[model samples]
Target chain A: MDTHAAYKSRWLPWVLLLPSFVILLVFLYYPTIETFVLSLFQVAFLGLSKSFVGLENYKILFTDPDYRQIFKNTVVFAFFVVIFSMAVGLALSVLANQRVTGWRIYRLLLIWPYALSPAVAGVIFLFMFNPQSGIVNYLLEISLGVAPDWLTNPTLAMALLVFVAVWKNVGYNVVFYIAGLQNLPGEVLEAALIDGATPWQRFWRVTFPLLSPMTFFLLIINTIYAFFEAFPFVDLLTKGGPSNATNILIFNIYRDGFEYYKTGMAAAQSVILFIAVVFLTILQFRLGEGRVHYGG
Target chain B: MKRLVTVIGLSALLGFAFAAEKVQITFWHAFGGGRTAFIQRAVEDFNYTHPGIEVKVEYKGSYRDTLNAAILAAKQGNAPHIVQIFEVGSQLAIDSGIFVPIQDFVPAGLEFQLDDYIKPVANYYRIGGKFNSIPWNSSNPILYYNKDIFKKAGLDPNNPPKTYNEVVQACEKIIASKAAPKCITWPLHSWFVEQWIAEQGALLANNENGRAARATDVYINSEAMKRIMKWWKGLYDKGYYAYTGKPEDWDGANQLFVSKQAAMEITSTSDVTFMQNASFENGFELGTGFLPTADGVERNGTVVGGASLWLTKGHPQKEQEAALTFLLWFTNTENMVRWHKGTGYFPVLNTSVKVLEWQHWFERNPAYRAAFDQLLQSKANRATQGALIGPFPEVRTIIENMIQEIFQGKDLAKALAEADAKADQALKRYNASVKK
Candidate 1:
């Protein structure tokens, strides 16, 4: 078979791609452009009224202390979630990859958290960490003679959100890493072993470098997850509460748009969040392009 | 086989004809759990009794979600015939221009008994001397205390705290006696602040609580709010207040009280039935009282905090009429009594209250008496009617977050100032957008 089919008509190729392009235009491009335009206006009464105010919405975002705090919270939350999930995911994947008798069961158990939606996970954690009657507090009171307020305390709330996000996302990361581990050229690691390299050195100098491509891919996936997919956890658990301590950007957008009916402000927030994730992803790619060691 | 097929086809045709003859109207409400079941039962009764109208009831997620869904659906020209909007969303609902004031649907000289409705509730939903929506489920906050804890602390179980000083004194004895881990708890909700401000006979916003004009400023930083916050902060500082740490965590507060972790909780009267069940389940005696007010301030009564049913515009005349019929029947005296008995919400009809009193309903459910007495004792004022603001939900969230910040050691003055600024900004944007 020919490596590439040479179409005789240029319009034919365009026509063939029309379906996907149209879908992207309708679902992706139109909404993004609409959100950008809507962000310039002050929308009221669930968009029964709208008046353009130029960059007033964006200016508010820049000047508003609450929005600034949310932005900082998002960054901090994303950083911790990405780092911890990836590290824990890699460790778990390595263990699951071992040729132990119950390795299948271990993998299945480790991957079950990924099957639960963020909202469900949030609900589970919410009951467990409830300050009044949650099992966590009940157990702590029994053992430590002190029960910390889990959902209400600002620091603890944020920490709990990060913890839940990492716990939910680690399974996803582990799945990818396991596939990456199975695909790694065993000969390279074996050569390192034969050349008198220690197990740790073999991992860092050979196996780790070989898995860079997977790591790069996981980095982008985890960052996007942290940015957007972490919303439900915050919503179900904290509701961006206890003084906006755990209020991430996405949750703030939801509150403004859906709860408060401040569509224009929420649209403005959406644009900012979009730009932030795009910039972060681009930065990840630029950095990864230099370091990712793709094997021949 | 041919005979069976013929019979099935005929029945299908008949079913379609039957469904088409009825004026179908959809009703979206914000009730969940057992209350949803109660609403379903009422709607079924309505459907069963009114054969010409098929009232389809839907359980929308929450008051905010229901209102938003209605507005969005209205924009799409698929709005339900009726939507239950919280009292705080009254201004927004009216300003949306998508709802037909229920008064418009009232036939002239029909003896609709509009005047028979309770003053506070009617006042809350009525704008410009006309009811914008039919007041349905209405509630006010009341104090729920564990009588056993009160007795354990040597405080009179029957007589609950009525003022901030009395609450603090009670808390002192309760804490000193170690009856419970905390003395009191309430959802860190802005509703309480609004109620307390009303209790002090202070308006939450200018222009007669936005009844005279569109609200442009919020009184979050006013002296009235300061007094409320100071008292609240004092309890927090003294470690007598149980801080659930979440904003608007009504269930958490309820748990703290029901589980005997806290001796008292101030929550909505709608939770009266829940409290009764919880006290039974948790093996405690529940006592109810009027929500405590600031010291030395004459109580002005709490505002109505539940929702009302609004008729959406753009429906067919038949559907609209059917929706009006459903709304009227849903809030009629008989149904109101049933609603009150089923849920702890106020029976918003004077006739319903009369019937309940005549029936001696309150004697059996004495805990409900506290809520009813509080509502009756409330003076009809702009504050008690509650503030009408376009951005009420946002302003509430800000106030709640501010309270949380203050609880976490943020300077009270700074938190109030910040909350006031944010609330005013929201009001400005809302007013501007609606003005255009």
Candidate 2:
């Protein structure tokens, strides 16, 4: 990989790679280390009155029922957001891949929601589904004669948060799915058609197997997105309650560290969340390793 | 030639040193929306009058946002010279050690007495024997109602509810009359709960509300709280109340009131002007009164509900003096009256109230008198003095969540007990973090 002329010193590659390593050390390793140290100490504003607590913060967090409930909430929220967004994205991509008039416009429109920031997505969904003056409630009342409070009812609130997260993320997933669909070889599908196979049969036996790599890649990305990026919707919408109904881990961490100013507790929550995301990512990679088929 | 040049250089340097200059200081506040105009005008007036010092005001979003910003800025050694922190955050601000007490920062030549501040409003900010921050734009909760809705419901608008039981009776009448879909609606705010507790002369936290010392216990499960929570849950169960969901959704409740979905609401006295305008614009009669207290008990007053001006430390003494000078100037009798008239907050100075009364200001605007009387008539007891726990805002959130759970049909006693234990844990954690 080295393109430069041979150098006398063995330290040349190390010197060239030092900048990125240092950047990682400062921004990533530094904060991680600080979080571990902070998780063991009770501290507040400007690091004043830091006292060593010997993992007391973690013990309290683990022992608390509310914190455990929050962990379960995070896992359930991530699972729903990832699976729903990916499934909807795949279905939409299949529809958009057809050679029809205005298909280009449809594809462009399908990919547009990916451009919205999570906070903006939150606000748009909030206004659109707002219990008071939202058009969705207005329409539901007019047509169905019932308007459920989408942001307040515990089950509906969680469902709406997941729905909005999926809606915001499906566009990004669509772009990848469309690429995967286009990259499939035409010969296999054509042969399947001649062998008296149905289109559904062709898709399952021929097309889906070839699309596994994209699916595998998207699984990891979607899991991470749902775990980390989806909390903004919860933050802007419910603030983790109508009684802690939507208290996802990350939102709780923010409440702990920023809102409540319990830095030690927040840091411990962060460390736990980091482990969760890492574990989820590793699980996806291991589970998908054999199933992700390479090109023929 | 060398001697002449040297003398000219030294003379120029000495003249520059002797010249008077205005020390510019930044004041960060949390007022926004229509309130921005009033504060901006005040800053302009201060700048125009006090040419020796310049006061620049920045609206730093909500009280929490401003406090968080100030905390981070203090860490970076560049906090604003003055920060307006809401009353709930006072204890946290005090413990942050980022402030120079108002007593120490008052200009030496000025004869300003902290005693001049209104008793209840000033009481919340004074810890020990000293005022940590100057009370600015203080408010108390009051009952606001749609008089037209009352008349429609065959209830006398002039005779509003004076107790929680009476509130239920009034709400029942309103509901039966079908004048409003709900008899009452309010944001699920813990502030109102705190006020209700204080109305019974109950401490929110032990250790004299953290005034005598750091509070390790909260009175969330006390008899007073139990009674209040029972009534609150009754309101929900009897279909007499509707909640706007979030504890901070005060604006939504305001919409419900003005839109005629709710007949009555309890809100900050500072919102009196806004509610009045909404009432006028929406074509409803606005009636104001002291917030309802429990019947059969002598009603104590509510705690103060607004921000205070804090002079930040780590600045040059001259800047501190200039900031304090502007703080004094900005809160003088005339300015306080101007602020009280502009916003429905208290004048915060006895002299200012005296001036307004003499000027027939309250006479012309009779609506202002309700809050004025509510706060001024308060007895200076520990309950009305307001709690000084370091984690008050977070504890308030726990109380809010408990109320939400109760409204959702959770067992009131269990929720309150659990919430109290959780709040005590939070307070203990906060106390440990800040202990030296």
Candidate 3:
């Protein structure tokens, strides 16, 4: 027998990979490279005119106070949306995992918001938290006699966005958690329980470590969701207003490019966003690898 | 092979059944809901009246989105024959070099008179002393108030506030009456600010509101703006104003008015029909008035708020002619009446106004008439001509942001200065790019 098993035809593997490679190159790589190239030029006349203006767009990004504020807002938006959603998601998943009656229904209800697109989610939250007319404020006034202005106040608006982002994604994380929990070895858990370990201790010592891989995977996916997929939410709900308080990176690019017709600036902003997301995912993998346990 | 032949044969047969030699044309607009129905009616009527040409209409999201799509389409050589661009995009449309001036199609197979168009409606679309696009649907901002709230607040329902100072006094009274939590509701739209600046006989940007020449600087830090901003801030500070803080929340303001959360509101005249429905549903009598001016200055008037139709280049001459003919008929006195009565937009032609006057339409529909009067009373000045610039939409966002900051307690003068600088820079960049 040969030491290595090989494909019947080496060309078959390349042929099999060709479809995916073509799709990725056309859909992803081409646009990404185009953005990088366009960022170095001044594009106008509806993309008919292009002039090389190296580093000028980036210089404006670095110099303009509005751009600076928007960039900071993006970082803050991504940081809060990812960290808080994952934490809440973990908590919800654990609660949903309990052996209780109606838990399945509860889980189903928790996952409902995940079915909606970012625009729909934004609309749902917008109607729910509307200051004067929303049910949330109505109930708040009925109970406490005070309803905080949900959209007008900058802090509250950002917090509301984070809440909605988490609300929409928590179910996704919960599903993974449930799968991870189901795969936990019964013998190990029984051994821990028979040793008189408390329920919380069992979860921390055995269950949590076993679920680390799922958590690590989710961290990467949720970060991308918060960074790029939240454009429609911002556009539909806040439109990057109340002093540009909720103007995150993606929506800012849309407003600058599509709405304002500043192609070069938008391309530059896209590159910056790409770099930030890449750096963030890489940082997470490096710092988080030690904590992920691959149990035997 | 048999199936492929059958499919090709069926498609050719279908093509012969319709639109074979009709010179099909596409019209792009941003209207939905009720307005979309209006467009469909016109399209049906046109198609029925002229069997030689067929036109299809597509709604492309909103105004900004539609304009972006149209521009990109032009670049790809697939542009539509007709596009409805909002009045603010006039300059960009002209600079686009993508349209054959509808003016070039003058004497467009009809007894069309350019002067018959309402002055303010024509003023915004006229470039280089020629109408670049046909003014289609037009609107102006007007003050809308709750008559019952005004009456309760000791302000006469028949007589609304007419000056800036009067408005403040009325708002104070309304708040003191405790009928609503706030005296008035305001949307953070830069259009209103632009209108107010014009009402005070002051231009929003230098170079004759960007009409005489390309604007190099924005006059946002003027005394009028500071005074207006200071007054606006005072209302919020005094708890006499309600703000939702979403920049384009026109519907939100309407809700405020209908729910009695605010006594007064300012919005496009195109909203009159919707306001009537709200009034019927909410059990409040809606009163209308001209937008109040700064205390001592005469109210010059307002710029048009609706959109217009342009005959795009690159379309076949026959298609462009058909599109222009559709527009000419679309704005004729009869269709104008239908459009104005149906949509609450201004009747773009004076002949339509005469017909409405003769029909006692104004008396029957007083709120609509208030807007008509507001436009007729407008002074032909640069301020009222409206700002025409390539980067107008961005400058508007900057002004909207500065306004929001001011409302959030940013220093008024500093915010104005910052907004002015941002707007000027946007204009400079835009001018530089299109300089060739």
**Which whole-number lDDT from 0 to 100 does residue A111 have in model 3?**
83
Model 1 misplaced regions, further than 4 Å: A1-16, A142-145, B1-15, B109-111
Lowest summed-lDDT stretch of 10 residues in model 1 chain A?
A2-11
Question: Which lDDT tens digits does candidate 1 get at residues B7-35?
Answer: 99999999999989999889998899988
**Per-residue CA lDDT of candidate 3, range B320-365, in tens?**
7777777787778899989999989888888988999899999998
| Model 2, residue pairs in steric clash | none
The superposed Cα distance between candidate 3 and the true structure at residue A278, in angstroms, equals 1.4
lDDT for A151 (candidate 3) = 84
Candidate 2 regions with alpha-carbon error over 4 angstroms? A1-3, A6-22, B1-20
lDDT of 3 at B256: 83
> Over the stretch A1-296, how does candidate 1's per-residue lDDT look in tens digits?
86346887658889999999999999999999999999999898768889989999999899988889999999999999999999999989988999999899999999999999778898789878887678988899999988898876888899999999999988998899999999999898888889999988987898788889999999999999999898889878888988899999999998899888889999999999899889988998898898999999
- The A-chain TM-scores of all the candidates are 0.95, 0.95, 0.94
Best by lDDT: 1
Better of 2 and 3 by DockQ: 3
In candidate 3, which residue pairs clash?
A: none
When summed lDDT is taken over every stretch of 10 residues in candidate 3 chain B, the lowest stretch is: B104-113
Q: Which lDDT tens digits does candidate 3 get at residues A142-209?
A: 99999888888899889888788888888898888888888888999999999999999998998888
Task: Quote each prediction's TM-score.
Answer: 0.96, 0.93, 0.96
Q: Rank the candidates by TM-score, best first.
A: 1, 3, 2
